[model samples]
Target: MMLDDLSARPASVGLVAGWSFPATVFDPLVRQLPGDEVVAFDWSTFSSDWLGRGQEERAVPGLGPAVWVGWSLGGSLLLEAVRRGRIRPARLVLIQATPRFLAEDGWPGVSLGDWQGLRRAAGRQPVAAAAAFRRRFDLPNEPAPSAQLAATEGLDWLARLDLRSQLVSIEVPVDIWLAPDDPLVPVDWPKHLELPAHVHVHRFEQGGHAEWLDHAASLARSLVRPLADDPGARSAR
Candidate 1:
């Protein structure tokens, strides 16, 4: 199946941002989402309040039946919503995201001390922290004014949130895109992920934390096809 086939199946598609990032971060990728209408979920619109408090105020709005794409923190939050029964998407495209962001029980992830440092920087010096965060991902764009707040709150969420136990409850088929070269998300993180056989995992050899944006065209092209169309085509380096 191709983009044309996907466009005929879903009338609209959704794009979710990660952490401090906004929907604008996915603008380049949205342009390549076949011919379907794309809905960019801007966290800013949700509220100026902290993410933990604001995120609970409303459910993720429905976008009919479509493949929802999320990256990093955005992907985690999407799964959180799913676990809470807020939304049910037809399919999920998760890029550089994990069930648990913090390292635990031999799983590769950010260390507790490192996560603490990030949390403090985000809370006390948000602007600087946001800049540093973007620099880590090699992102060239400037974030929105409220991004600092969101980033801080996101780090707070990262420190305490865990989703490993919720994986079994996620019914939607997922396509996980992992960038082995990612500095933040460990290269061998997938080895720790215990997913159902129906879930497809793809590991890219050359990309970073922001691979979803850096290789938007190729990612969109690959994902526009049926989920199982080419399972192992891009799984290995």
Candidate 2:
């Protein structure tokens, strides 16, 4: 976990990165965010205790009700945390995220064979497997060397966890950003799930899975707009 104090401004932003990639991969996007403080959580270190840790024991300290953002697998973790009453944020942003990653009876997602293949490869050769995974998504940065174990755990969670039924019950405001061209997450999957009235979905025409890499500035503006408009809004701590 890394915290960047951008300014003395009161607002803070917490970020969780996806599988295979390190938290530093969010540097570009974090630089563009308007928050005074930014906390980036690394999968390798944070995944182990994500659900077990208490609220005050979270990576972010004195981070009262900030805008929390998660991408890909990280988004699933965030959803799980919220569902379990782990962390509450003023707003939640999910990028290229889906409630479930593996294809179900009627859902569109990664095939079982492909998911299993990746899991096996990661078990045998994590570094090479992660490299191939990053190449497949055209991820911009290389993950830290210790991400091997975390990668396997992430795949397991992706295959086993499903949050479609939990979406409607979350009390926080959620903004889900989707890319129509994203190969990993199907844009049409949301149609199969029921979301709450506070949940809003936005689609971008370009930028595949790593939209933040291609459109960081635009995403930053969109992320801060609501906070800028409503400076007084605070989530339950």
Candidate 3:
């Protein structure tokens, strides 16, 4: 869909940020998304009690029949929310995300040793650990201040959470955007996992994990284009 088409019909767009980052990280991408009333969910807003709750009891407020976008860890959380019937979205978009973070017997993912080491580093020196992560992903050195406890909890979620089996059950139309060069999420996931027919996958040549930082305009366009052609998304609106 053209930018003009997006502006002609305004829709609600909910954005969920990745681990340790604030919603402000989406500012660049948000500016490129025209006519959409954007609602951002910050990691700081997630309390310990809320994070500890089961899928059915965990509630993500301010989400409705809108186009929900999530990045990395946020995407995993959204998948769980949808699977457990916590929220129903018109469309779901996952950016450089995966169903399982840690490597399993046949699944490709982060090594258990590496994941554990990162968690330990974050606990001992959060700022340094975050800086190292940003450098590894080619992200800005200092984007925003993250809540340490929340970030640690997010790491915990990444280590233990596995949603591979439930991914096919979600009824909403799903869009997964990935980059082969993304150091964090493995590019071979599509081949390893079984996705529902309704799920569409888009692979970019370059855009690492932080695509929004460099290709905000193009990313925003890609996000709305499919929705523009989706009759179900329009009808629900």
Candidate 4:
């Protein structure tokens, strides 16, 4: 497992929670991590209540500018924080993230139909909406999400949002690990993502939206290696 491997490494980490995903989903990886090696972060437990008053910089104090491993929605929030100059991670690994989720005339993120359908489905029946999302986004090999809880989380996201325009301001070392087969946050989104000069990207052949969950340790290693090995080198961005 990724944790077993990272446990031996002498570095700090901050794992961001995926969209509509509970912290419990990460227990497998978190439980095995070196107690001092990584820390858990998310808007649910940390910033859910105190949010909007501004950003929370001390999300993980002892982690010492952690290497952020963000999946799905977490990736956007991580980028938002970085753009707002809120949380500063040592490095960022975006696992199947899209800078702009909704589609526009010129932009081809996700179609308005997709967003409308999601909203309508959620309005009609929360359980069905959650199931639809899970079936569409989470890979077949990934964990099954709780419909009720997931729907609630999704509602939260719909309420407070929009970090797309901030991409130009992100200054940290970012490596986006995309999934060629992702059915939800399509890979095309990243290829066209007009990010800051410091951002970077990597692609996966088969993993879906929850790509990192299927292989978090490998992803962690792949993403962190560059940052750990070349802190000052600063890749082509």
Candidate 5:
């Protein structure tokens, strides 16, 4: 929606935030980027719209081959969108994003308390209670996406469409930044995901949930903005 007012720049970044976290969180990070960087996309709702909209029509204006950056759930979304061919990007950057969230009995990543707690809070409690539940779950140590994108009618459609095998189909370079102290996503989930050969990863010292934005700017200097010094580094790898 904000893109409607934005005039085209030679290149710009597009962002889709995690569930309910809001876009303002990225203002500091994006502002630090070159040019007048743009990175606010609709919240989880827009991702839903993209799903039922289908992979065939997922590209938004100015989003074609744009550098896609997201945090937590947003990170998973950028990659999934690529899997579905919903949108293509010049580069894909994810901070603390993982592929699968739900944990298997054997998987060490997520816990039943994490999943059920969400179900109870959102399903049983009112907005205030749900917000409180989200605050706790969204913690970096947790691993629940800062925002859940697939809960709505459209996003559910997206969730129904799986793309594990489709990750290889994406031609663009992918970059992942994981927080060592995350909450919702827990740990070990990152190990389970199979990223394309083009994917690159950087682990952060801190910034459990909102890392580069809320955690610390030092992390971004070396961890997030590798391209600032050389954009071709990822593709060359």
Candidate 6:
């Protein structure tokens, strides 16, 4: 799916990071999107303090009618927010994310035992496990301490939360980025989902789960270009 229409950019772009990845990691991507208002929903902070604290806790200031770009667990969280009417975005950009984290409905996902084992390891050796997990994704930066704060709960949420139906119900334009070789979330997962007609998908031949880190420039372009065709964005401009 190509976003060929180019014009004005969105009024705001919300960058949502994956679990354990801080908003700062997206600085490079942000730099690529100049002249557009941008806000980031820090995964570390959200996980640590706002997991199940209720609607008020999930509120992000100045975050409406923008293109919401979410990666991994961040994408699921964003969908949940939309499901609960917490935020309404003009468009959605999901990277290496799936509606369900745990295997269900014949879809590929992490098994409960493996998910629990990782959580246990994180519990036993928080820092080490954190570093190791990042490295596994080819991300060298150290995750924020807040990420580790909700490690156990975060894993539980991943293991149980399912948003397949929510994804299909969304009507706004959407883009999904995938790495075919992703070990966690399968590349074909999105194809199985009965998403809306506006949903477009792009798969990278080579990249780790954190594809944004390596394809920052390409992703930045893909994300910003679509805004030009967004009716709401054109009206905002």
Reference-based lDDT, each prediction:
0.67, 0.73, 0.71, 0.60, 0.54, 0.68
* Model 6 C-alpha lDDT per residue in residues 1-237, reported as the tens digit of each score: 222344546457887777666777788777766534777766655444344556553455455547788888888777777676666677778878888988766788877777777798777776666677777757646545454543665566677678888888887677877786787788778767776778776677675687657777667666665534433211110
Winner by TM-score between candidate 4 and candidate 1: 1
Per-residue CA lDDT of model 4 for 1-237, tens digit only, reads 444554346367667666556655665556545667777665354345224454454545443446766666677767766665566677777767777666666655666677677777776776567667777664432345455445555444633455656665566677877766677677766546577767775665564666556555455455335544532222222
Worst 10 residues of 4 by lDDT: 228-237
Best by lDDT: 2
Global Cα lDDT for candidate 1 = 0.67
Is candidate 4 or 5 superior in lDDT? 4
Candidate scoring better on lDDT of 5 and 6: 6
TM-score of every candidate = 0.81, 0.83, 0.83, 0.75, 0.69, 0.81
TM-score of 2: 0.83
Report lDDT (Cα) of residue 72, candidate 5. 63
Candidate 5 structure quality by residue, lDDT tens digits, 29-110: 5554543555576456546655446546656545553677777667767767777668777777776666655555644445
User: Model 2: residues >4 Å from true position, as ranges?
Assistant: 1-10, 34-36, 53-65, 141-150, 227-237
Write down the TM-score for model 6. 0.81
- Clashing residue pairs in all predictions, respectively, total 0, 0, 0, 1, 15, 0
Worst 10 residues of 1 by lDDT: 43-52
lDDT digits (tens) for residues 1-237 of candidate 3 = 235555545357877878777777888878766635677775444323224356444345444537778888888877877766677777888878999999989989899998888888888777778777777778765455454623577788788788888786667888887776777898678778678888877666565787646656666665555444533221111
C-alpha lDDT of residue 237 in model 3: 10
Model 5 off-target regions past 4 Å? 1-10, 34-36, 58-65, 105-108, 134-163, 186-190, 214-237
Q: Judged by lDDT against the true structure, how good is candidate 6?
A: 0.68
